[model samples]
Target chain A: MVENRPFLSFLTHLVLIVGVVIVVFPVYLAFVASTHGNGDFLSGLVPLLPGPNLIENYRLMLTEGISTAGAPPLWIMLGNSLVIAIIIAVGKIAISLLSAYAIVFFKFPFRLLAFWIIFITLMLPVEVRIIPTFKVVADLGLLNSYVGLTLPLIASATATFLFRQFFLTIPDELMEAARVDGAGPLKFFRDILLPLSRTNIAALFVILFIYGWVQYLWPLLVTTDSRYYTVVMGIKRLAATADGEPQWHLVMAAVMLAMLPPVLVVIFMQRLFVKGLVETEK
Target chain B: MATINLVDLKKNYGSVPAVKGINLSVKDGELIVLVGPSGCGKSTLLRMVAGLESVTSGRIEIAGRDVVKAEPAERDIAMVFQNYALYPHMTVRQNLEYGLKNRGTPREEIDRRVKEAADILEIGPMLDRKPRQLSGGQRQRVAMGRAIVREPAAFLFDEPLSNLDAKLRVQMRVEIRKLQRRLKTTSLYVTHDQLEAMTLADRLVVMNNGLVEQLGTPTEVYDRPATLFVAGFIGSPPMNLLSLESIAGAPGFEGLNLPDGTDVIGIRPDQLVLDQPTGQNLALAASVELLEPIGGESHLHVRLTGSNQAVILSVPGRPDIAEGAAVTLYARPADLHPFNRESGRRTDTAVANP
Candidate 1:
């Protein structure tokens, strides 16, 4: 990158093009597969180009679904995924922002102890605490519900720690000025702190939203009802149909649909996400 | 406008005392500047007065109302911080309007006050711009505008001009002085810059090590510093304190009579002259070590030939004196400030001036 050598430039672009193809080829194949009819794979090879059954396959999957797979329609699953992802993202951000605010600003007995406890939870991801968490949710009769899908995943130590670090960078003089300006603690948090954290929240929301969207293991464990099935779990069901060969076209269509929301979120919030992660506005 | 009274104000961080018990009164509409080096507790004292820092043991009365237990907002005071601390996300108008809005000032009143402050600080054009969009001086004005819109009983400035460049600092200092005078607001300004303290203060409080070294009009403090600390801290190049042992047995030592226990004598740099003396004066033969010609005046660093003591002479314009040249420096008796080494008090006064 530093030199103007012609051979180096060609080598650099060659390396980049190869890397791009390696990453993008699978997604391209999935799109090509989704556009084909059920009979197209009779030759035991995936067709690499567009097919005539694109709309019909997507419509069938979104509406009636693959009935032989015994899974709910793709539309219902997509809606459920959207709701859970949104709730989880928003809930994580809200809780993280408040917890970070309290940890950074207030001084009370065992303040650092509380922060350390939250920090320690970073080691205990959902998988590590799954059994106990499941037990609690079952006892509360939250199975097959949206709350069950989102609540256990909502308390994010990483996001809280990120926000805490960000808040610490904010000048103490600002708080003093706000206090002198007659703003109470809550008012200051809302007016000054929240606005200042816009980019960070955007960045975290994109991450957390995708985290919620692709959730497979926990949602599979929590939800028995087809009413609560997510697009991710639904995709798995479509591919692993109990009887006969799986419909590759319909499965590929579902996979494409499942990847859409997270991809769109990243695209839309990319600028803010990069800014939040890389820069400190204050 | 209101008067501010600090009754034995004290602050302690655990066992370490930041502000020792001290009492002072700020009269209505007076601009009292607290000047000190870093960690002298001037900022702490001001914060305590603003109710930003808790008082260890003392009373604070703003407008004759005790406010030691009051929240910073309830104290009804506004402070301009050293970094300006303007809200980066908010427009300049919102920054100015925040305090008034929080106090529940009606929309019309807030607008009017914001408008007036913008006019006074000449920041009207910047009202819609965020703090980051403005230059340092413009942000500083917005900060002042914030305080002005508060309509608080008093203003506390914590080294507000320290972030500005030297030229802008002088300009802002003048504007702050002018604004304080025009508004007739009781103000407390804190800075370590002695020149700033001298120019802006209605009365100056020179602090050292959590206690007041001297409190007087700038001229009074400049003319006669109460203690050794004030004598050194309040001057540009600082007053030179020559020990008696250094100047004893010199040419002029035999004729002059200093007070008892006068172990040290303080003399302003400008008081030491090159011209031949006409009055009772101490004349020391010296050789120039260095000559610093700083524009209209020059500092002549000289060492006395008798005892090899270094003394600075402030001379008008630049003379033809070269380094290592022999010169005779003179100080009259009246200009000699006698001090006791152990007590650190002026020997000329019977009792300490408080």
Candidate 2:
């Protein structure tokens, strides 16, 4: 911008173009595979061009699915994914918001100790505690239920920290003003704090929804009942048939379906997501 | 609307005292301005009165009721903050109505109060707009409007205009003064700016280092500052404080009877005359060091000829004086403020004879 550097600008554009292509190449290949017949992949390296069997592959996957793999229809898996993602996103936001509000506004014994304990949980991901978490869920008889799938993942340290940081940035005077305005604590949280946190909640929702949707290990570990299988984890069952040969067309179709909702969410809420992400970090 | 009494109010953050015991009575419907530099605890005192900060000890009474254990809302006070603190997501109308609604005011009552506040603040057109959409001054009006709609027992302003531009600050200062006069609301306003303090306060409480240095009418504090700190802090260009030894041998002080412990004397820059006038009791020969011509007046900085101490004199228009030129400055007996050097307390009696 400072100088009229045409060559440098050209080089910059070229690098970005290369980056975009590298990132989009795999999705493009999957889309191409989804549009082909199963026979096209048997000939050797999967066909690069579109085939006439696109509609049939997707329709078959969505309605009847691959019966041999014991996987339900694509629509059913997509519905389950949607429900689990919504619950996880909403639940995490609600819990994190309340905890963050309490930490920022109230004085209690061992307050910092409580905050530190929550912060320390960031070091232990679900993968590390998966076995114990599963045992607890099974003990509670919550396996195969929506609550079991979402509740275990709802206590997000990152989300709570983000909310806490955002709450700290709110001018202390605002709270004072609310207090002087005759608003009790719950009323202030409801009428002022929640409305102010709209963008943050939305942004966290996008991130958490994607997080819930892409869950493979936890859902696989818990949901033996196909009724609760998420589309993200269900695609694995569809791909790894008992014969060892994956139905390349149908698997690719399921993959595309599994990736669509989250991708759409990110694309549509991009502005709020970016704003929320940057502000929460601040 | 109500009187506020702070009875030995104190606050401590752990072991560090923010506001040492402060006792002051704000008369009914009086606007009391607490003026001090940052860290002087003026704001801390105000917050304690507003119930925003807890009192480490003592009591705060509004309308003769003890509010030491009460919530801020229960204290019946409204505060306008430095940052305005207008809810960013709410419309100006909604911001004004939020408190009334929370208190379960009827729909018609809320509407009437909101309209009255909007009319007074001249923000009727922007009531539907969010805070971010309005200009800074408009947002400030909305903040005031929010406080106005509450019709509480008192109003507390914590450096509310400190964030505005100089022109807007002056404008808002006049408007706030006019509004308080019309509403007859007991108010406690805080600011570090002495000019704002002097102009807006019915009575000014000058604070320093977590204590009240002096409290009086603006004219009283300016004309008779009780302590060296008040004298130095309250005036523009500040009162020129000089050691008694520096002026011991200067002209016109040969036979003056002075107090024994009087070591420092303060002179207002405007009262230091360049010409020898009738009834002038003190005169000092000094050489000019600098002349700052600010529009209609000039500030002449001069050093005493026999000593290195510098003093400033405010003269009308530009004086025909050059740097390094010898000048004689005069002051009457009443203009000289005498104080004890050790304790920084005023030592001069009410009467001074030359």
Q: What is the C-alpha RMSD of each candidate to the true structure, in Å?
A: 1.7, 2.5
Q: Provide the overall lDDT of each model, using Cα atoms, as 2-decimal numbers.
A: 0.91, 0.91
Cα TM-score per model:
0.98, 0.94
Candidate 1: tens digits of C-alpha lDDT, residues A1-282: 389899999999999999999999999999999999988887898788999999999999999887777788899999999999999999999999999999999998899999999999999999999999999999999999999999999998999999999999999999999998888899999999999999999999999999999899999999999999999988988999787788898899999999999999999999999998888777
> How do the residues B147-235 of candidate 2 rate in per-residue lDDT, one tens digit apiece?
99999999999999989999999999999999999999999999999999999999999999889998899988998888999999999
Collision pairs in model 1:
none
Regions more than 4 Å wrong, model 2: A2-18, A278-282, B349-354
Candidate 2 lDDT for residue A42 = 83
Per-residue error (Å), model 2, residue B321? 1.1
Error of 1 at A131 (Å): 1.4
**DockQ for each candidate?**
0.90, 0.61
Summarize candidate 2's per-residue lDDT along A182-235 as a digit string, tens digits.
888898899889988988998989989999898889999889998999999999
True contacts kept of 1: 0.91
TM-score of 1: 0.98
Count backbone clashes in candidate 2.
0
TM-score of chain B of 1: 0.97
Instruction: Give lDDT: candidate 2, residue A177.
Output: 87
